[model samples]
Target: MGGRVLGYGTYHVLTHLTSTELYSHCELVRNKLVPLK
Candidate 1:
């Protein structure tokens, strides 16, 4: 039970990190593809 909980926590943290990284990457690409004022 503890192991499962730990696994879930780790997965959630990693997912959060990945989501932020992906969003940053998308922003960079969008800046290159689209002009922003």
Candidate 2:
């Protein structure tokens, strides 16, 4: 996948950050992530 797709996926996940369904996975995934923008 390209950055475009990656960006979209990130946006989708961020938008759903409060979702109970993905909370655990999101936390694990975002634990070490830092935004440059």
Candidate 3:
């Protein structure tokens, strides 16, 4: 019902936020590393 839809929406938002945070962390680490050919 409506509650189930809300729960799913919240879950999706959390999942997206987690992935975005992970991606930013990875980018940060990469920026700190020395580049090689």
TM-score of each: 0.80, 0.43, 0.87
User: Each model's C-alpha lDDT?
Assistant: 0.96, 0.78, 0.93
Q: Is candidate 2 or candidate 3 better by TM-score?
A: 3
Model 1 lDDT on a 0 to 1 scale: 0.96
| Tens digits of lDDT, candidate 2, 1-37 | 6999999999898778757657887777787574532
Question: What are the per-residue Cα lDDT tens digits for candidate 3 across 1-37?
Answer: 9999999999999999999999999998888784742
- Predicted candidate 1 versus true structure: per-residue lDDT over 1-37, tens digit per residue: 9999999999999999999999999999999888754
* Each model's total of backbone clashes: 0, 0, 0
Task: In model 1, state the lDDT of residue 24.
Answer: 100
- Candidate 1 vs candidate 3: which has greater lDDT? 1
Off by over 4 Å in 2: 18-37
Ranking by TM-score: 3, 1, 2
Query: Any runs in candidate 3 off by more than 4 Å, and if so which?
Result: 35-37
Top TM-score model: 3
Candidate with better lDDT, 2 vs 3: 3
